[model samples]
Target: MWKQLILLAFILANCSATEVKKCSDDKPFPLAVRVLNCEIPPCDVIKGTDMIFEIDFFVMKYVTKLTTLVRATSFGMTIPYELPEDVRDVCTNLMYHAYCPLYATEDVTYLFKFPIGNYPEVSVKVEIYLVDQDKDVATCFVCNIKVKKGPTGNTTVYEIDY
Candidate 1:
């Protein structure tokens, strides 16, 4: 039994985060997020391609006041996605208070059609932030993903769903 335990420990230590997505614990805002699209963490994405993300989360607060901001980082570069300026004013209150906050404060599903830049085959970490109008981060989320390399042989048009 002891030997078995030792073997298990060694295996766990050798495991890489590439096979698992590492997300930071919720702070300031406590929330739990579920990736609705992939089976594992560090979702597999093809380099120099576009990927889609679907997520469901619940926030521990009243939806009366908050701002949502999304940012993606890879190869030490950060990309920020914000509410479109043209419709920001109209959508401000709509998203923040879309649901009746009598019970759950933040509960929604988001869809992101993100482009995977020319970053090499590496691990990409994405951060989602919910902040107040004052620029204070209300809640933060981190998701680890992998960027796969392009195929070396002939590629099919149907296989271009990177």
Candidate 2:
């Protein structure tokens, strides 16, 4: 049991931390964006695993609209993703009611878990945009992540980490 615990500790200590990639936008965003933390992703995840996303942001202005898009792709091609109808219904209502910005001074953290599936190349991208009432972007954040299979089926590749 001690050996198992030590191994787990070593793995956790040596693995690279997840990165907060730059968000590209066509127009200037009104507010500043900062990524507090991005946890490391598993090299490969099996289907049905709960892929969690935890993000915290400070609103610099009064935000009115918010939208998020999560997708998987491989070799520059789009892969489809569909949430269950029940989940979709909750998300639709929850997004508007729970997350719709009400105060400018409030610092909010939004977290969601995605049901993982067979993703090609383990490439996933998450995009989130906060817009104002004029349909203009208040802030946009995006991250593109690619997971590489480790040696021995489950080993860390420090070269391509993050």
Candidate 3:
């Protein structure tokens, strides 16, 4: 019985969702944010790997189209990263066969995969935004992440700010 209990606890901890902060006070925040294999801030991401994110959100108003915006802030500078044409369209990425034309009162989960590239080893604040067709933000959130070198590279150090 003790072994079973410990296993359950470990499973719960590993599967727990990440707590993220809202990017803007005026915009709606996601109900939950789950970064696969990550449950805490300053998530360690190795280069050449994919960071998978699952965002649970509710639509407060009808939206015919949705777009994703990703930005990384470091050293007091924010740089926007343009996703591929297919990944930029959020509607196509909705899970469970869900498509565009999301209606009010509908709960949806969006799965986003960000491919890590050859980025410098550093800590950055990542901001994600889902914009509706009207150019208004549907939901937004922010989190801190640390990028590290891959296995073949030398050890990289990251400076994190609270």
Candidate 4:
């Protein structure tokens, strides 16, 4: 009888824990992450063999105001689906807001331009995983993006649903 009561209590406690909503607690911004088209006024002048893409990630926290910004170490490819790589160089060097406050929004943009030797199709993806400072462990926010390469390369917007 005691064992049954303990088991029930454990189950209840586990179920009562708060489930982290994807990107919701972090910010009030649009649930959908939209990357607008890449446009350079004079299409002719901006033409280059290798295309450069800009990616921005916004952080919105719903819980305690976060004080530290975990340095992003790596990111996974979205469209082509490649393995994760060290993106510290791209993120740390070019981020506007490295760290964000609780419930506040911060944007980080990376200039991703790769040579188009054989691969014509261009797709950019950045997955953001939240790390707990105290625990020093990673949390699965499970946020990812996959943007298609456009013909004109004017404005390529990728909308991340979920």
Candidate 5:
């Protein structure tokens, strides 16, 4: 019985999602943000690995297209990370058969795979945004992450709530 209780507790703890802050007061917040292998702030991102993020959100109006934007800030300088052309289009990455022409009150899940390159080991503030067809912010969130050097090959799967 004790073992079963401990297992249940561990499962529940692992299932908890990450808590994230909005990028701006005017920007809309996502329903939830989950970063694999990063359950808390200062998520450790190893160089030459892929960092995966899942965003759950809802649209307030019809949207024919969506784009993803990412920026990292450190030491008072902000650098925009340009996503590949294939990954920049958010509509193509929606989960569960959801597609654009997203309508009001529609729940959507977006999956983003970010490749960590050869960047200096440091802590950074990351801002992720999803913009609609009209250039309106659909979902925005900010997370603090630490980039570290490590042996990199395949993507590592972990849970992080932001």
Candidate 6:
């Protein structure tokens, strides 16, 4: 028993002596876009009609949270936003959100609301990244949204560690 205790103490000491590198490095809180009451994307729309949308996101910067970028691409579709200038170095190694319809590339927290007119069933991809690219690590969180149209929207929140 005495030998076991001594061995445990030695291990503990070594662990304490080792230096830990924090990815965030004492950065302040980050501004994360809080997507709330997001309704299931609306059904196919007719051409020449106007659609209005409202999006919400919380922006806090320097916060220790992950930010996501939304990407939309197709074989022959003209996407509005070109890829950002900085992500070319690590785009291939990106991890993506399995269910997000759009893919993301930047670290910006965006609440996007746009009108969809005369478009076919469009598919999207969502990807997230660590704001500090040097860390070479990726973290992702899952959020839930429900929309009831008109005036009442239902939503649920979940916390995940990555």
Go through the candidates in order and give each one's C-alpha lDDT. 0.54, 0.47, 0.85, 0.33, 0.86, 0.31
The list of candidate 1 runs beyond 4 A from truth reads 1-37, 59-106, 152-162
Sort the predicted structures by TM-score, highest score first: 5, 3, 1, 2, 4, 6
Across 70-111, the per-residue lDDT of candidate 4 in tens digits comes to 221123433332322343233432344543332335445443
Once fitted onto the true fold, the runs of candidate 3 whose alpha carbons sit more than 4 angstroms away are 1-11, 153-162
Question: In candidate 6, which residue ranges exceed 4 Å CA deviation?
Answer: 1-38, 62-71, 75-78, 81-113, 117-162
Q: Write the per-residue lDDT of candidate 3 for residues 1-162, one digit (tens) a residue.
A: 999999999878766889788886767999899887688888889876777888889888999999999998998999997788788788989988888798997889998887778889999899999999999888999988899977665766453211
Each model's TM-score?
Answer: 0.49, 0.49, 0.85, 0.27, 0.85, 0.23
Worst 10 residues of 2 by lDDT: 28-37
lDDT by residue for model 2 (1-162), tens: 999999999776544344544456463332322221235432244343444444455555676654444444456776545655443222243322356644666555444445565444466665545444656554455555554432455644332212
Model 2 score (lDDT): 0.47
Q: Which residue pairs collide, candidate 1?
A: 42-145
Cand. 6 TM to true fold? 0.23
**Model 5 CA deviation exceeding 4 Å by range:** 1-11, 152-162
Cα RMSD (Å) per model? 9.5, 8.8, 5.7, 17.5, 3.7, 18.1
> Could you say which candidate leads in lDDT?
5
Worst 10 residues of 6 by lDDT: 50-59
Q: For residues 1-162, could you state the per-residue lDDT of candidate 6 as single tens digits?
A: 999999999655433311111223343232332322222332223232322211122223233333233333445553443334443223322233212222333333322222234345444322223333334233332221112223235744342321
Let me know the TM-score candidate 1 reaches against the reference structure.
0.49
Q: What is candidate 1's lDDT per residue for 17-68, written digit by digit as tens? A: 2222333563453333444245467777777765554334455544444555
